[model samples]
Target: MQTHFNSEYPSVEHLRAKAKSRMPAFAYEYLASGCFTEVNLARNTSDIRQVQLQPWYLRDFDGADQTTELFGETYDAPFGVAPVGLQGLMWPNSCQYLAQAAVDHNLQFTLSTVSTASIEDIGQITNGRFWFQLYHPAEEELRDKLLDRAWEAGCRTLVMLADTPTFAYRPKEIRNGLSIPPRMTLRNICQMMMSPAWAMGQLAAGKPEFQTMKNYIPKGLNMKHLGLFMNKTFSGRLTENKIAAIREKWKGNLVVKGVVNPADAEIAVKHGLDGLIVSNHGGRQLDRGQSTIVPMYKLVPEFGGKLKIMIDGGMYSGADIASCLACGADFTFMGRTPMLGVCALGKYGGHHTFEMLKKQLQQVMEQVGCSKVSKLREHLIAESVPV
Candidate 1:
């Protein structure tokens, strides 16, 4: 697919700037900000940029290809859309829009448990080929029900969110009143009014809700109580017992996201998980944590063959994706880049972002004289500066 985005928004940073300009301040900050000082947030991308690739002029190579295989599935590209909660709040109907785009592009689209679209709806869009990310519910019955719903919808891969044992203290979110049962302050209202296009889109789409969890929420609960309900519904932390139970219940491929430690990766392997995504909740859950790329670099050599190793955090471009692959990541995922596209161009955002990333990755492969996605590691320069 060719990028429909013009030269003005040729890069992810460009799309992000446009997204910030087009979206309301509160919404943009919610999507953009990390917890507290946001040190890890900035480090995520900055550290990735530190990785340098060497071009080989002497090597002969055929046309570059970005096809990648993970968990028995072959994808057109090496990177996929990382699941993000409250996606519709960024752009109305964005979850479905992204799901459809992923299907059309033959890429993986993981749907969040807290996303605006329902499991069945996205299942229909992707023909049950999409991955489902689960936030462990407080109740076993609720967890079982959600799993059943996902399986019935034809979802085969389940990504269990392991980070976010506790919510991060985001000063921007607090000041903007973007928390649960969000406070609609006058400043926020004015910010929304300023972004007329975003306001109009929200009006047309109706209020964003947790479509997957709404069925379990008791009716007539006010926004404050609704917040309480959400808090009570998902416990955030996953224990060994909880993981054991899920392993027993879920017969399909199981993956644990938010793994930044080697010990945790070993635990997931012991638990028989099919894959592990080395992430730090996109730097939203922990402000002082190490950049995801650092841990990915350390853990890949230890557990690359033990299970399918993937990484997602701070990757905004195809070069970033290539860097992760060179460092030993089997696959890559990006959360905010695609949303920036959607927020910047409305319905055309997802496709344009995918195509742009594909083009950029293909260029990187050609420059390195690498022809296949799996061969990206061969282009890694040994003794390169540490990320």
Candidate 2:
């Protein structure tokens, strides 16, 4: 990978810009857009900026620590890659790229239910730094089988996304004529032709098929067929009862992702879940809903120690991770950064992306006079404005 801007391009925005140039327009939109209005998506970034960090100049800042522990495991950084569905649509073998990067960086990489690569494939790369996110399959037998496969793959944690009870209406996908497995219409062909690099990657990867769900479905299933299978196989609505059932099924570190409200966080605690990723599905679920930061102060304390509280959404810089920790997040998840890394650098991109975030977080910590990542709360200051 040739250097684009050699001062390290420390910010995720720079990496994203490079990624957008390499990727197709629909791929960029798929990773960037939110639901209707996109207010929540905007707020996720703006709200983080609102929280001010207090710097202690008198203290001697010798070294910086960016490590944190969650779910009985200590991660080298406070950030991990969040699960993204249809990642192959963005770039070929995205799940594998992200997982391998997470392993190289000593961070957790979550694989989505609808990811193109299978758990076994990703496990081979990172030796199972992979966390599987479930969509709550309609068929109990099939869902259990997938869980068993994840266990066999050495997955220690299970993340059940609680927010996406109903899939939000993404206008971009509809307008782009996008469906699962992807249809190559005139519009899509032009989009692909615009980015020969991504098109060639797809060609090499054999047309971006979903290996994760291939075994469950019949042979000769195309995008339209897979889309219909997804619609029929997984029920979006996940109730408390269903969660309880899941708790009974899986004993390992169970995480309830997509929590925005404090009450729902309490429900997760009551259900004996190990952790909660406070997020608005990265603004993909409810556009009008509040950003994850808006409810962090309220929800973190509500279930911080009893259950680890993490966040994801609108995080494009290391300062964003600092802001999340200062506000209330125990750990943060990088949804697009690692993908952007792979997009920009291919096999080694994920490693570079993780290093960039780690460097940024270290700089922020040293500047704020923090020695350990856990001491981030010591420097936290709630402004009259918002952080």
Candidate 3:
């Protein structure tokens, strides 16, 4: 395989196109679709496009610094990969591939609760460069047990997902029949036949399984039943007491994910969370919720220097990242974009995505007359009309 993407496909759209060609219709739909209507999904990127950069020219020529330090560790890039579930379904051993890429790039990679690989497995592969994302189970004992497993696996950071009270109504998944432990329907089989390379990879890896939940779920449940089981096993409810309980339980740096409101930011600080990610679940959860960047633009200033503000949503190009920095995010996290790159290009996906984003950022930095990413704020000019 060439293991390269087309020039036109530099952004996540490239991988998405490749993924659609490679994955079954059901699988592709599961990964690509957002909740009802996908209005918010489109809004995420559109909202980012609204912000224009004010570039300056003819400044002293010095290299820029993209390295960012958070909770004592320095990452070569300002952004890291956010967690996504069932990555192997998109591409075989996708979790391992992504984790290794993050390690090689000196970036953070978070493993989801329903991830195809175990935390320990990814921990070994990523060499502790991995973080763990938790889906709060209804049973306190089970929830605590899962957290303990993450800690025992040497995961240094814990990201508690707070947005999912119930699974969002993703129309594509329903129409595609994306149940747990996927079934090979005629529709799916036809779709899979279109992409021989992707089919071969899955055949080579055997079949994808939720490695983390293997110990928890009963072995008899099929894919259709798996979705229902997940619905029952996880609780979507997020409460202040739960946050306090988790903070008390996890000794490492704890970050609350899916924050869109400044009031929630204050509550996170009140709960003593180490960091907060301003996200609308990448516009996958609430269709009417404000775009992640808009809230981040407003909330970061409100929280000011007291809290570490991170943004995750609609970031594609390095220019998008620079825009986030210019707006006020201390660091950014990308979920779908990097995964799309990896699944599309295999081993080199991480390299290409990082280079792509870094190149864009460096160019923006040079043009904007900013020597450091922290100084990007001076270039921000809020638009009177959202682009």
TM-score of each: 0.96, 0.94, 0.94
| CA RMSD of each candidate after superposition | 1.7, 2.4, 2.4
> Which 10-residue span in candidate 1 carries the lowest summed lDDT?
221-230
Q: Give candidate 3's error at residue 149 in angstroms.
A: 1.6
lDDT of each: 0.87, 0.80, 0.80
Q: Rank the candidates by lDDT, best first.
A: 1, 3, 2
Candidates 1 and 3, the one with greater lDDT:
1
Give the Å error, residue 364, model 1: 0.6
Candidate 3 ranges beyond 4 A from true positions = 1-9, 225-227, 384-387
Q: Is candidate 1 or candidate 2 better by lDDT?
A: 1
Q: Given candidate 1, what's the lDDT at residue 367?
A: 85
Candidate 2 lDDT, 1-387, residue by residue in tens = 332233455567777788888888878888888878788888888988777788899977778877778777778998888988888878887778778767766797888888888889887776866789998898789889988988898888999977877657777866766666567788777888999989888889876666788788777755453336557778877789889988898978899888878778878989899888888888877888887788888887667779888888878778888888887788899787788888877777777777777778888998989898878777878662252
Off by over 4 Å in 1: 1-3, 179-182, 223-230, 385-387
Q: What TM-score quantifies how close candidate 3 is to the native fold? A: 0.94
